[model samples]
Target: MQRRRLLPLLLAAALPLLGGPVAHAQAGRPIKLVVPYPPGGPLDAIARILAEKVQPTLGTVIVENRPGAGGNLGADAVAKAAPDGHSIVMGAVATHAINPWLYAKLPYDPVRDFAPITLVARVPNVLVLNVETADKLQIRSVADLVSYARKNPGRLNYGSGGNGSAGHLAGEMFKAQAKVSLVHIPYAGAAPAQLGLLGGQVDLNFDNLAAAAANIRAGKLKALAVTTAQRSAAMPELPTLAESGLPGLVVDTWFGLFAPARTPAESVQQLNAAFTAALNAPDVRERLAKFLAEPAPTSPAQFGDFVKAELAKYEKVVKASGVKLD
Candidate 1:
C-alpha cells in the first residue's frame, strides 16, 4: 500500500520533468508557408526568398500559393490550419491589413485569426506614368500629377493591381490628400497593369517599386514620386509624396508571416526567431534592398502591434476614401 502511494507521488513529482511530450524539441515536420497572391507577385517573391533562407533553419519550408479574392482564400486556409507551427501564411498588405476594410466580408479576421510572427519587409509603391502620357500631361512629380489631375478631373486615370490592393488604395489616398478627381482603374493583376501602362493604355500606375523600378530605369515608364515617407534607396533620385507637398502621406506595402490563432506561444517564438534570423542575414537584406524594400525583423509581439496599427490606419483610409469591393 505504501509503495503504491509513493509511486503515485513520484509520478506526480516527475510530471514536470516529462513536461508534455518534451516539446518535440526537434520536429522534422515540414512547415507550409502559404502565399495569398498569385505567383510572381511581390508577396510571392518575398515568400519564396524567405523560404529559401528559412528552410535551412527550420526543417523543410514548403511554399503553397492559394491566390483569390484579394488574398482572402489562403489567409482563411491558414487561419483554420492546425496551430502546430507546421503551417503559416505569408500575409501582406492586402490580406492582413487592407482587406479587413475593403471587403464586405472576409473569411478570417486579420487580428483574431492570426498569430503574427515577424514582418519580413516593406516595399514602397512607385508612382509611374507612361512615357508618352508623362510628356503630354507634363507630369514631372507628385505635385505635378496632383495639379494636372485637379485641372483635368476624371480625364486622368491610374491603374492598380486590383480593387482594394495597395496600389489602388495608394492612388485613392493620393487623390484624397491632394484633392484631385483622378479616376481609378483596377487590373486583374499587377502584370496586366504594368503592360497597360507600357502600352500607354493607362495614364499612370501606382505600381510596386520592384515591379516598376527596372522599367522606370529603362525609361519605358517615367517614375514620378515614391509613395513612402522617404526616398527609395533603389531610386534615390525620386522624391517622397509627402516631401513633394502633402505631409504625412506615407503608404508602404508590407509582408509578414503568421500562424493560426491558437498556435502555442513557444512555437510562435521559435518561428519568429527563425524569420528574424533570416531577415537579418546580410545577403537577404541586400537582396530585399535592391527591390526598394526595407528589411524589417520584428518580435512576434511587435509584429502583432504593427498589424493592429496597420489595420486601423487602412480602415480609416478605406472609410475616408469610401473604397469597397464585393
Candidate 2:
C-alpha cells in the first residue's frame, strides 16, 4: 500500500514536466506570408526584404508568391487561413484598400478577414515619361503635364500597375484634381508599365521610384514629379506633385503585414515588435533608402487604424475615379 501511494505521488510529480510537449504544441508553427503579385514589382521586392529580415525573428517565415486578380487571389488565401499565427499576407494598397473599392464583389473583407501587424514601408510613385514624348510635349512638371494633357485632351495615356493599384488611383486623383483628361491604361504589373513607358506605348507611367530610378539616371525616361507629399531621396532634385502646382496630390505605395484574424493579441504584439526593430536596423534602413522607400513601423493597433483610414480614403478616390472592376 505504501508503494502504491508513492507511485501515485511520482505520477503527480511528472505531470508538470509532461506539459512541456503540450505547450510546444500550442507554440505555433512556421508563418507563411503571401504576396499577391509576381516577382520584380515593388510589393514583391519589399516582401522579399521583409522576409529576409523578419524570418530571423519570426522563427520560420515562408514567403510564397500567388499572383492573380490584381492581388485579390493570394489575399483570399490569407483570409481563409486559420486564425492562428501561421499565415499572413504582405498586403499593399492595391490588395488591401483599392481592390475593395474597385471590385464589386470581393471574396474577403479587408478589415474582418485579417489582423494588421505593422506598416512595412512606403515608396513614392514618380511620374516618368518617355524621353521623346517628354521633349515633344514640353512636360517638365506636374503643371506642364496637366497643361499639355488638357491642351490635347484624351491623347495622353497614363499607365499603372493595374486597375486598382495605387498608381491607377494616383492618376485618377490627378485627373480629378487637375481637371485633365488623360486616358488611364492598366497593365498586368509595374514592370510591364515601365516597359510600356520606355517603349513609348504609353505616354507616361507613375512608377515606383526604385523601378524608375535607374532609367531616370540613364536618361531613358524623364521624371517630371514624384507623387508624394515630400520629395524622394532617390531623386531629391525632383519636386513633388504638390510642389509642381497641384497641392495635396500625395499618393504613395504603402505595404503592411497582416496575420489571420483572431490571432492572440500577444502574438500580434510580438510580430509588430520584431518588424519595428527590423525597420529601425541600420542595414534595413539603408536597403530601403536605396529604393527611396521610407521604413514605417507602427503598433498593431496603429496599423489597424491606418488600414481603416486608407480604406475609407481610397473608397472616396475610387468613387471619384469611377473605376469599377467586374
Candidate 3:
C-alpha cells in the first residue's frame, strides 16, 4: 500500500511539468520566417540575415518566399498559421499599411490577424533620373525638375514598380505638391523600372535607395532628393524632399516582423527580444548600411502604434489619389 501511494504522488508531481507555459515554450518545431517577396530583394536579404543571427536564441529559423499578389499570398499564409509561434512574416509598409487601402479584398487584416514583433528597418525612396537624362535636361535638383516640368508640362515622365507601390504614391505626392504633371508609367517591378530609366524609356523613377544606390555610385543614375522627413544616415549628404522644396513629401518604406494573432504573449516577447537584439548588432548594422537602410528596432507595442498611424496616413493618400487594385 505504501508503494502504491508513492507511485500516485510521483505521477501528480510530473503532470504539471508536461502541460504548462514552460513546456509549451520549450516544445516546438523550428521557427519559419516568411518573406512575401521573391528571394534576393531587400526584404529577403534582411530576413536571411536576421534568421542567421537569431538562430542561437530562437532555434532554427527558416526563410521562405511566397511571392504573389504583391505580398498578400505569403502574408496570408502566416496569418492563417497555427498560433504556436513557429511562423512569422517579414512584413513591409506595402503589405500592412498600403495594401488594405489599395486592394478591394484582402485575405488578412493587418492589425487583427497578426501580432507585431519589431520594426526592423526603414528604407528611404530616392528620386533619381538617368544620368544621361539629367545632364541632357539640365535638371540638377528637385527645384530644377519642378521648373522644367512647369515649363514643359507632360514632357517629363516617371516610372514606378506598379500601381499601388510606394514609388507610385511617391510620384503622385510629388505631382500634387510640386503642382506639375509628370506622366506615370507603371512597370512590373523595381528592376524593370530601373531598366526603363536606364534605357531612356522613362525620364525618371522614385526608387528605394537600396535599389538605386549602386547605380548612383556607378554614375548611371543621379539622385535628386530622398523621400524621407530627414536626411538618411546612409547618405547624409543627400537632401530630403522636405528640404528640397516640398516640405511635407515624406515616403519611407519600412519592414517589420509579425506573428499570427493569439500567439502566446511569452513567445511574442521572446521573438521581439531576439529580433531587436539582432537588429542592433554592429555587423548587422554595417550590412544594412550598404543599402542605405537604417536599422530601426522598436518594441512590439510601439510597432503596433506605428502601424496604426501608417494605415491611417496611407488611407488618406490612396483615397486622394484615387488609386485602387482588385
What is the overall TM-score of model 3 with all chains considered together?
Answer: 0.90
**Rank list by lDDT:** 3, 1, 2
| Cα lDDT of model 2 by residue, 161-189, tens digit | 78767788888888888998999989987
TM-score for each predicted model, relative to the true structure: 0.88, 0.86, 0.90
Clashing pairs in 1: none
Q: Pick the candidate with the highest TM-score.
A: 3
**Per-residue alpha-carbon lDDT of candidate 3 for residues 1-326, written as tens digits (9 for 90 to 100):** 99989997786566444433333335656788999998988778888999999877777788999999989999999999999788999999999999999999999999999999999999999999988889998999999999999999999999999888898888888998999999999999888999999999999999999888888888899999899988988778889999998997889989999999999887788889889999999999998887677999999999999999999888988887798899
Candidate 3 Cα deviation (angstroms), residue 271: 0.8
Pick by lDDT: 1 or 2, better one = 1
Whole-model lDDT, candidate 3? 0.89
Number of the top lDDT candidate: 3
Instruction: Give the per-residue Cα lDDT of candidate 3 at 107.
Output: 96
Give lDDT for model 1.
Answer: 0.84
Off by over 4 Å in 1: 1-25
